[model samples]
Target: MNSLEKQVESAWKNVDQQKDTLISEHSHHLQNSVDEELRTLLQSVRQLLDDDGQQLEKDVDKLQLIAQQFREGVEMWQQKAQSSVKAIEEKQRVLSLLVEDVSVRTEGRRESLIQRQQQRVADTEDNCFRVLQGISS
Candidate 1:
């Protein structure tokens, strides 16, 4: 080949090499962009999962606290009920003693009244007998 043909062939080869290099670089850049976008999306998903997990933990803690409070309330109410029952039993015992005392006093009063009535009847009978004897004599 002549010198001009050689130069022309060399120029064409150079142009072809530049075209191939540009296409390869563009493909690499597009792949990098897609990879970066996928990475960003994955990071967002991870953040959301972390937030949800934290919220779930907080909710579990709140539920546990409420359960503890409920248990305490039930125990306190049971104690109150026991104390109330004890108070009522004491009152019942006191009332029983009062009733017994009242019954004894009433029985004593009835006996004394009966004795007085008998003595009065005897005195009236003696007076009547004396008056009848005097009249006869």
Candidate 2:
């Protein structure tokens, strides 16, 4: 039982480590991507402002496209992060419930075994007493 508990604890620890690594790696990647997109957007907007006539409309369109792409990318990353968090939270909840259930069952079984052993002891003592009385009589 102690070994089982230790195994469970070790498994949870491993899961936690993996979750942390995944979260950090994804978050860093998302942050870098967002930063890069922002930089490009800023550059595009500056170019639009600096450029002279005729192709001014094209520059404006390009800036708008860049902004739109950045918005979509950020939104996508936000959704992914939210989903990942929700999944991890659900798993954690399940693990907690499982641990609680196992602990309760183990305690119940231990108590039952202890009661049975105590009863056996009491019964043996009573039998011994009866045998001694019969011999004395």
Candidate 3:
């Protein structure tokens, strides 16, 4: 009976050791899985950051194109404005010349009209004197 009891104790100790070994292996496997998940999360974050950088670069390129277009448009507008200003200055010069010419012509016409009125008055006086002389005769 003593030998049978010793055999049973030995068997129980072996079973306990197996159980401890299995628990330790399970804990190691769980830690490895957690490490793998953390690594995957870090990689995804890095990829996201890289993608953001690429998108920002593209945006900057688009803004540069827009700025170039705006500059060209402004340059064109300035050219057109300068041309319009030149045209307006020429028109003003022509208008001033026309006004001067018309003023000179108008003054000449007024002087001619005054000279014709003085001649008409002299002819009327001469006719009146002739009538008076014929009556005296």
Candidate 4:
């Protein structure tokens, strides 16, 4: 080859090497950017999962507390009902005793009234007999 052709060939080789180097550098930068983006995406997904899991746990705890409160309220109501029933039974027993006492007192008063009336009737009969005898004589 002549000198001019040799110089042109050497220039072409230099341009090819520079092109390859630029391509390799661009590929490396692209790979690093993709890796960084993937890491960010994975971290975001993990955070979301953790937040959802914690919220689920809180909801479950609230449900359990509500259930326990419901159970305690029911138990308290049952206890109140039992106490009311016992009080009512006691009142009923007292009322029954009062009725019996009143009945006995009323019976005693009736017997006393009857005895007094019988005594009055006997005295009237004796007076009438004495008056008839005196008139006949």
Candidate 5:
């Protein structure tokens, strides 16, 4: 039981560590990308007055579309992560119930076996007593 507890604790720590690593990596990547894009956008804005106004408006619209898609992708990732957590929790709950049931059944069987062993010992003692009495007579 102690070993099992240790294993579970280790597993939980691993999960937490992995989650933190992923979040940090994801944020770092996004931040670098955003910095690059912002620099590019700033350069474009500086030249906007020299370019055709209609073309500038179209480019802005395109950028808006790309931003919307990025947001959708991030939302989808969040939903998937949440669903995975729920599924793992449900599996853990069911497994715990199964282990508890097995433990209870094993306990009942152990008590039954102990009673049978005790009865056998009592019977052997009675036979020994009778034999000793006959010898004395």
Candidate 6:
């Protein structure tokens, strides 16, 4: 009877150890599953951030291209405007020179006409004095 009791006690101790081992294994598996899920979530978030960064870079590149085109357009317009202004200035200068030449020619013609009129008046007066002298003789 004492031997039977001893065997029963030994069996009970073995069962308790096996139960502890099983509980430990289950806890470890649950922890591994939670860690795997956390890792997957972190990877997905990283991928999303990478995609957003790439799109941002593309947007910046487009804006830079547009700005460069705008600057070029402005430069072209400025060049054309300057060319037009220069052309107008040249035309004005040529017109002013022509006006000056015409004024000088007109003034010379007027002076010559005045001199001729004065000579004609003197000649007529001399002819009349001779006629009066002839009548008196």
**Candidate whose lDDT is highest:** 2
Q: How do the predictions measure up, each by TM-score?
A: 0.57, 0.58, 0.55, 0.59, 0.63, 0.53
Return the clash pairs for model 4, or none.
none
lDDT of 1 by residue, 47-78 (tens): 66566887766655665566567556655765
Q: What's the ranking of the predictions by lDDT, best on top?
A: 2, 5, 4, 1, 3, 6
Each model's lDDT comes to 0.68, 0.78, 0.66, 0.68, 0.76, 0.65
* Candidate 1 residue-wise lDDT at 112: 97
> How much lDDT does candidate 4 score?
0.68
lDDT-better candidate, 3 vs 5: 5
Task: Give the higher-TM-score candidate: 2 or 5.
Answer: 5
Pairs of residues clashing in candidate 3: none
lDDT for model 1 comes to 0.68
Off by over 4 Å in 2: 1-60
Q: What's the TM for model 1?
A: 0.57
Residues 1-137 of candidate 3 have per-residue lDDT tens digits of 34544565575567558755765576567557655765675566556656688676665566556656755675576567557755765675577557667867898999988899888889988998899999998
Checking candidate 5 for backbone clashes, the offending pairs are: none
The TM-score between candidate 6 and the true structure equals: 0.53
Candidate ordering by TM-score (highest first)? 5, 4, 2, 1, 3, 6
Roughly what TM-score does model 5 have, to 2 decimal places?
0.63
